[model samples]
Target: MKFLFLICAAQGRPTATPVDNGTVVGTLGPVDDDVEVWVKEYDEGSAEDSGRRLAGDRLTGHTETVRVRGGEVLVTDGPFLESKEYIAGFDLIEAPSLDVAREIASKHPMAHYTGIEIRPLPE
Candidate 1:
């Protein structure tokens, strides 16, 4: 089994313009719904380590922003959307099977409707 973890560092490019147009002007495709384990932020040390690892484990230094495919819509200074549904990032961990994923997701830090979706990876 394989998994894809999507970490939303920052919102992607904004689709809407400043002209107060009623409609957004960018593309927002469907995200991988079968995501497991969501969190506001990871451990500080792990965060730093992940950043370092992203730069090929180079400790020299690198930028501090991560982008996602459909991240731009929900972030803004003002309330652009009606619902408060927002996503930070997701973890797609693959255990031996779905039951294992369920067990892992059940112990998530933020439990409840924040149920992690466990599914087979697309070919």
Candidate 2:
């Protein structure tokens, strides 16, 4: 099984730079001594609705605890980041092709709202 990470970068603010390739799990940065990062396990056919339901649920569960510095708290529905390049959310795609991965990503809940960058884990 491979793991994929969907990271959000700071919008011209003091924040960690998004790493392109590395271990699936690691601390990207810290806030109040707490490391900020996300992790997900991926296998074939993992980006479909069934997979998304589980993954989305997991991410949503942690929404309250995840903090962004200088991040706006939305009173109404809004995009995840204030920056154009910042990631709003991610899906763990098990497909072998980039087109397939991107297609899966394009249908994600966050895709309609913010940008989603789909990159494979470095072997």
Candidate 3:
């Protein structure tokens, strides 16, 4: 029914920028190598291969983690977890099935360099 695509990339990677050829590069090579990466979510109402984009965008730099310990709220800079990678962006997609959702995620350029986590949402 619905899925959340967590677009992750290596820490400190640069944002997606359009090259001179007017192609968007998302943390890796050109997103328009042979098939362009669909940066947005697929349309829910249409079953067409090329559907309307629902909602998606690249996240800005910097992140914060908030936690409550000892009855006090604590806030810290950067992600809550320490690792070599971080969530670079996200795409909220509507797919007919998990298999199709995986297909959509594979099209992302970030999937080539890092990884994309697909989580299905409850109906």
Q: Estimate every model's Cα lDDT from 0 to 1.
A: 0.34, 0.39, 0.65
TM-score of each: 0.33, 0.35, 0.68
Write the candidate numbers in order of decreasing lDDT: 3, 2, 1
For candidate 2, which ten residues in a row score worst on lDDT?
Answer: 32-41
Separate clash counts for every candidate: 0, 0, 0
Q: What clash pairs does model 1 have?
A: none
List where candidate 2 sits over 4 angstroms from the true fold.
Answer: 1-89
Winner on lDDT between 1 and 3 is: 3
The model with the greatest lDDT is: 3
* Candidate order by decreasing TM-score: 3, 2, 1
In angstroms, the error of model 2 at 11 is 10
Looking at candidate 3, what is the lDDT of residue 18? 46
What TM-score does candidate 2 get on C-alpha atoms?
0.35
